[model samples]
Target: MTLTIWIDDWQIQCCGESFAPGDVVSWKLLEVDPEDYADVVGSERAREIDCREEHHGQGEGQDPTPVEVVSVTEVHCRYGVPPGAADTMNCPVPGTTVLVPVDEADGWAKARPDVRFAGYLVTARQVRGGDSDDVSAAELPRSPS
Candidate 1:
């Protein structure tokens, strides 16, 4: 059976309505002012939502947590994306923003064994702290003055 994880933090919302033992809330309330992620939620995030009539995805290898699109860049044009991922996402071209699995980009090639193209190394963004987004990842050499 496909297990559904109760995703807490990064959900960006909470719920006021009470439900029976396993009722799907569908709509949860969040503390964040709606404006904070208005653009994301309205566009990309909305599409990210699964639209099957079942409401719950029972498919193989489905992820339960919510992930935010931090930014989209060519897999090679941008560093930090893991190795072994295909040059397609890494090559200089625009593509759909990918939602990463909770464990980070460790399973790209292993999980998608069927796909030969090197894929992207997706990471969980909503859970990370400050400066992880803004700082450059480059390492500078130390110099003696």
Candidate 2:
């Protein structure tokens, strides 16, 4: 399934690896609380993925989840607004309260290279453990030698 994962700037600065589009990655993700991230994710989007229980990583633990990087976008939170009413934009702006991305790439040459932005937007597929073709093959009936 295609999923958008949020990675915070602090999390990146603390412990993050550089990545780009088309890169497959593994990360530990947690469910995104719609009410908590409504301002950044928008109400509609939050609800859309609510049932699916969208996941995100806080740059903790060794990544074990698999996902693919599709695109990277910087989330700019405007200034001089309510605590959680700041407008979010994909493009750069002046005096942003906070900056983050749906996807993350350390040392990106384009747009604010000096400044580290937010997180990453990744496409993740749901794969149940011990359910791969290899596992099935091993379970096949054995033929007498």
Best by lDDT: 2
lDDT of 2 at 124: 43
Tell me the tens digit of each residue's lDDT in model 1 across 20-85. 222322321112222222222234343332221112223223332232433221112112333576
TM-scores of all candidate predictions against the true structure: 0.17, 0.51
Task: Give the CA lDDT, 0 to 100, for residue 57 in model 2.
Answer: 31
Query: Tens-digit lDDT track for model 2 on 1-145?
Result: 3555566545555666777777766555555554444555455544433211112333344335555566665543432334454575343233442444444467342345433343443434433452311112122222122
Number of backbone-clashing residue pairs for each candidate, in the order shown: 10, 10
State residue 14's C-alpha deviation in candidate 2, in Å: 1.5
lDDT against the true structure, each candidate: 0.25, 0.45
Give candidate 1 misplaced runs (Cα > 4 Å).
Answer: 1-63, 76-117, 127-145
Worst 10 residues of 1 by lDDT: 135-144
